[model samples]
Every structure is written in C-alpha cells, then in structure tokens.
Target chain A: SQQGEEDPQALSIQEGENATMNCSYKTSINNLQWYRQNSGRGLVHLILIRSNEREKHSGRLRVTLDTSKKSSSLLITASRAADTASYFCAPLTQGGSEKLVFGKGTKLTVNP
Target chain B: DAGVTQSPTHLIKTRGQQVTLRCSPKSGHDTVSWYQQALGQGPQFIFQYYEEEERQRGNFPDRFSGHQFPNYSSELNVNALLLGDSALYLCASSLFRGGRYEQYFGPGTRLTVT
Candidate 1:
C-alpha cells in the first residue's frame, strides 16, 4: 500500500485562480517534499519542509504540514496555464535508508 | 553541473528475456536509487546503492537486482522479465547527509515487455 494518499485526484482551475491539494500519510516522517511533473516527464523538486516546521513558502507555492493530523496541503496562488501538471507529496521516513514514498498525485489543469 | 542521466531512453524485450539499464548520477553525488513507475501510479522504490554496495532494497523480487560502480554510477538488471516488468525506470542521486537526502532524478528509461 502507498504511504501517502492525495485527495481530489484531479483538479481544474481557470488562469489566475488558486489551486489547493491535500495529502494524508500513514506514518511519522522526518520531512515532506513536494514535486511537480509535466505530462509524461520527470519530476522537478518544488519545496521541502522539515517536520519541525509548520509552513513554508516559495514563490507562488505555499505548503503547510500538520504532524498531529499526519496531513499536508499545497496551495498554488495566481496560477497560470503553464502551472498545469501533476503534484505529488513524498514523505521521507526517519531512517538511514532515506526512503521517499510518493502518492498517486493530484493532476491540476489550469485553463488559459 | 550535469544532472542524473539514463541510457537507452526506450527498450523493448520479450518475456523471459533479460535487460540491463544504466544511470549516471548527478555530478558530485555518491548515492544512487532506482524506481519503477507503472502507468497511472507513483514510482516504487527498487533499491539504493552507495560506495559500490547496495545500501537498501525495496519489496521487489530477486529477479530485480542492481550494481553500483566505484564512480557511483549504477545499473539495474531485470532477469526473466515478465509482462508486468514494463514500466518507466527512474534513477535518482543524492548526497548522503546523516541518512537524509534531497534526491535528483533522471528522465527515466521506458521499458516495454512483450
């Protein structure tokens, strides 16, 4: 079974609108990282938030982590058509192996 | 700096055949990891290699094995391939810091098992 589960598997928003995606995990983690993948392409690292932190911001992306609830959310503000892609949250386990398990991902389509 | 690179972007093999995929880690990176991604799903970790030795392995079977060279480049070998073995094979590299890493990924080799 996958360690991370994302909600609203697919989303569509008009250009300039905001998009928010949520994720829930089953185990404790050391850090949570988000990645974006264009259609049929490799993933690009977006942001990484340590477990001790609650929120992080990078450009138009904001990520919030709630360890107590074992959940995280990614918010993309003032979106554009180029932002259309698949977003995945990978929770790194607290171990030497540094395992990075990914969820099915949330597919976002920003209509121009 | 050069990012991770994989060879033979695409391959086709029949069932019961064998295939070897290669990867070169990002410059200055010493750890390498492999993943298998079926369509419509997330990548599944195959194993990780460091210092010319395997450091970790996932739930894959013995038919799926790997090797790492002194230069930190790696190879993933799938023996007795099955139809289900077809997938996008990805290689990732990272600097090992206290057992934690921010991995850099390759474009991946797409394998088709006939």
Candidate 2:
C-alpha cells in the first residue's frame, strides 16, 4: 500500500502554539501533499514538497520531506482555533495522475 | 475564479437504488476524479477521467463508475447501492500537466443509503 500513514492520530494544543504531524509511506514518491479538512468538509490544499526538496515554507505552514526514510512532516506555526481540523498527507507515486491514495489522517485541535 | 463544484449537497436513497452525483471542475482544468470517504476514514480513490474517458482507476468495483464531459464536467453513478455505499462523495479537478498537479476538491455530496 502506497498510502501515507499519518502519525499522532490526534493532537491537542493551545492557540499560538505550534502543531506537528508526520506521515510515512511504503513506496517512493514524486511528491507529498498536505491538506486540511474542516469538520469533514472539503479539503483545502496546504502545501506540496517535491522529492528533491528537503523543506518548504508557506506563510505559517512548514513542510519537510525525507525520502531516505520515506517520511514527511507538516508543521503549523502560531496555530489558531480555525486550524482545528483533520490533516491528511498524500504521498503521490510517480506516473500516477492525481490518483491519491490517502491514509487515516491526523486530527488536530487548537483550543482558543 | 470558481473552484470545483458538486451538486445535490445531500441525498438519501434506499438500498438497491441508483444514485448519480455531479461535479464541475475548476476553470481550465481538464481532469476529474471521484473519491469516497466514509465516516472517520480517509478518502478512497474511485476513478479518474481525462479527455472524457477513464484514464486510470483505483481498486473500486465496477459498480462505482464515472464519466467526464467535453466541458470538463463529470458524473459519478453507483448502481444497486448498498448500505455500505453511504459516504461523502468528493469530486476533485486538476490540469493534467504531464503528471504532477494539485487537485481542487468540491464541497462534496453526502449520500445516505438506508
């Protein structure tokens, strides 16, 4: 299964604190994407890290990828209550056209 | 610009009935994909359509099918629905830039099979 297995099935933190989630996959990938889903609604794409890239930052979000370990991590800084949601990671395999195989995502809660 | 949009935000149908869900991709997107997300589970890919034809499929059964229109819109149809078919149906769209592109998801249509 090439599904990206997210770690820390659930996490709780205070507003202004940072939250981190990890994902591990079983196969090589071209890139990894992180998304946030609020209350089980539509998912909002957060960031994407290519295989050659080690780290990338977008506003308050930071993503790191370690292809050697077949793992990736997403970090949200200065979290707000609105950040409370399920975070999913999709390890996109090479040659597959957006056929994302997702694993159970990490649920994060930010207490205001 | 509008993102992906799905119709019939919610639906309720009895087992053995058929249901059709619709989706319109974001502007300029040429590919459409469908997924099923059960309660408390990650979304599972059903199939993907490009150029109005199924370019790739997941492990889903034939009972789960889809079509893409020339205008880049798509529809997902399930025949003889089962209780287990109740889930959040999500439609995503993206441009097939060779292979790598971000998918914009719709709000999804929640289906209940009773």
The candidate that achieves the highest TM-score relative to the unseen native structure: 2
Q: TM-scores across all candidates?
A: 0.95, 0.97
| lDDT (Cα, tens digit) per residue for candidate 1, span A1-106 | 2377888799999999999999899888888888888876777889888889999999999999999999999999999999999998888776344767887899
lDDT of 2 at B71: 97
TM-score of chain A of each: 0.94, 0.95
Across B48-95, the per-residue lDDT of candidate 2 in tens digits comes to 999999988988889998888899999999999999999999999888
lDDT of 2: 0.91
What DockQ score does model 1 reach against the true complex?
A: 0.58
Clashes of 1: 0
Q: What C-alpha lDDT does candidate 1 achieve relative to the native structure? A: 0.89
Mind listing the fnat for each candidate? 0.50, 0.63
TM-scores for chain B, in order? 0.96, 0.96
lDDT of each: 0.89, 0.91
